[model samples]
Target: MEENQINELVHSFITYDYNNLSINTEELDDGKFFSIATIEKNLGKQIFTPNFEAEFKLIKAISHPEIKKI
Candidate 1:
C-alpha cells in the first residue's frame, strides 16, 4: 500500500484454523481502488485448489468507485 492510501485488504478461509489457505493481497489491473486474492482449499492430504470464487465474485460485484464507511 502507498503512503496515505488505505488499501482494502482481502483474504478468505474455510475456518478459523485456516486449514484452507488464504490469498495474498494482489492489486488487480481492473482498478487501483480494489484488490484481489485467490484462496485455496484443502480437499485432502497435500491437495490444494481454488475455493472462494463465488465470494470473490460477489466482492468484485460490490466494489465501489469510491470508499465509504458503513
Candidate 2:
C-alpha cells in the first residue's frame, strides 16, 4: 500500500460462515471505494491480524454513533 492509499474497512453483517456478509464502503472523496481483500474461509484470520483489525476498529470508532453496529 502507498502513503496516499486509504483503505476503507468493511463491516461484515456476519453469518455463521460469512455467507451473508457484505463488503462495502461509503463513496469516497473521488467516488472511489475499497474493502477488505478477504477470502471466505480466511475472513476471520484476516480480521485478526494487527493491521486489518486496527483499521476496522478505527473505522467503527470514527463512524457515526447512531449508524454504528450492524
Candidate 3:
C-alpha cells in the first residue's frame, strides 16, 4: 500500500479503537491506544497481504464520523 494510505489506515484503526475504549490515556494499560504493536499482535503469524480495495472500504467504514457510540 502507498505510504499515505497506510498512514490513513493506521489512523483509522487507532481512532476507531480510541473511540471504542472506555478509557484512553497516555499511559499504557489494558486499554492502551490502538497502535502498530497492537496491530501486529492481532496480525500475529499472518502473512501481510495488502488488499488496497478492501482497505479502502474498511477505512471509509471505520472512519465514519457518524458512528454512534454504544
lDDT of each: 0.37, 0.46, 0.44
* Candidate 1 local lDDT, 38-69, one digit each (tens): 22222233322233354544544565533111
TM-scores across all candidates? Answer: 0.24, 0.29, 0.21
Best by TM-score: 2
Q: Can you list the residue pairs that collide in candidate 3? A: none
For model 2 the TM-score comes to: 0.29
Best by lDDT: 2
Quote the positional error of residue 22 for candidate 1 in Å. Answer: 12
Lowest lDDT sum, 10 consecutive residues, model 2, at: 31-40
Model 2: per-residue Cα lDDT over 35-59, one tens digit each? 3343223446653545556655666
Q: Against the true structure, what is every candidate's RMSD?
A: 15.7, 9.9, 13.2
Of candidates 3 and 1, the better by TM-score: 1
* Candidate 2 lDDT score at position 63: 72
The total of clashing pairs for model 1 equals 0
Better of 1 and 2 by TM-score: 2
Query: For model 3, how does the per-residue alpha-carbon lDDT over 1-70 read when each residue is reduced to its tens digit?
Result: 7666644232234353455566555543433344544444454344333553355346556664543221
